[model samples]
Target: MCCAHKNENRGAFIVLEGTDRSGKTLQCQKIYDYLISIGRKCIKTEFPNRSTDVGKLLDGYLRKTIKLAPEVSHLLFTANRWELNDYIEKNLQNGVDVVCDRYSFSGIAYSSGAINLDYEWCKSKEQGLVSPDLVIFLDINLSLSSSRSGFGDEIYENIKDQNNVYEVYQSFSNYSFWNNIDASQDPDVSLKNC
Candidate 1:
């Protein structure tokens, strides 16, 4: 069972995003563990919570088991994020920081790759959603990302696709909350920067 938050102020909403092999998950886990050890109130969550019904549909689309139009796929991904909005808001309101593995940026970049969805348009589609207070981008180049172990076999797992997404992510660097970290570094170094 979980306990109530001890702090008075709302908790921070931190998001981890990046190209493949960017160490988002690894860092998130490490951060979660450290926070727990130190008794900081927090909750670790992720987009496409596949246990949920909407996420079940998204799982099929991601796995190529279900054929969806790019537009449909984009909406499903957005819906997947929405599925967690209430929980995220409630946690943050209670002062339990939320570490999210992915959110709107992934939706925008990945969806654009399937077709010609403009970055701004993709951003607009996510209007009214709860934005992350901070977004840590694991910056990894195409070559390095491809060479990483366990590079996925999924639809958006190729050099072209990855590169496309990288470019799109790059385009969003102007945002004040976006923080880019050199993902090629050792885990400790990356974690320190993150």
Candidate 2:
């Protein structure tokens, strides 16, 4: 992982990462809500934000409307993160906690796992991006995740690709700030553990 420039007074930057149907979106909202309920200043955001121009291309790629080579797609994903780095930095510097649905790790995981790209090269793309204070990875077996609602809706939602993605996520288990949660558990249980 790249060393990020952290501010002592900044709010925590937490990111949720997982394979398809792994409940990252739901967890991100729940985390944000919980933080707010406790009177914490928090905001929710997501990667491949699907709002900026680069993100629009990413959205198209995810939705199967646009096709890109693995290398190009990987760079685009990183560019999308770069597009929002200032926003994340600003909120954090202002002491607003950020609960982001995805981030650079997902970029590396998806690109390297699904497309067999070089892992180190994929990681290099994220070199200067802001690193999260915590990375909550919702871990679930491929069989279980594949059975979840809306499975296979996206291009990389196949069992084979997800299995590869799962392995890639597993490889991140050693990161000091990474936490693995059993996503197969009940939402409340997962949330409480988090």
Local accuracy by lDDT, each model: 0.80, 0.89
> Which candidate gets the maximum lDDT versus the true structure?
2
Per-residue lDDT of candidate 2, residues 22-76 (tens digit): 8999999999898999999999999889989999998889889889999999999
lDDT of 1 by residue, 68-158 (tens): 8877878888888888889888888888888888888899988885455766767777877777778889897778888878777566777
Model 1, residue 7: displacement in angstroms? 11
Clashes of each: 0, 0
Model 2 clash pairs? Answer: none
Per-candidate RMSD, Å? 4.5, 1.4
Looking at model 1, residue 152 earns an lDDT score of 70
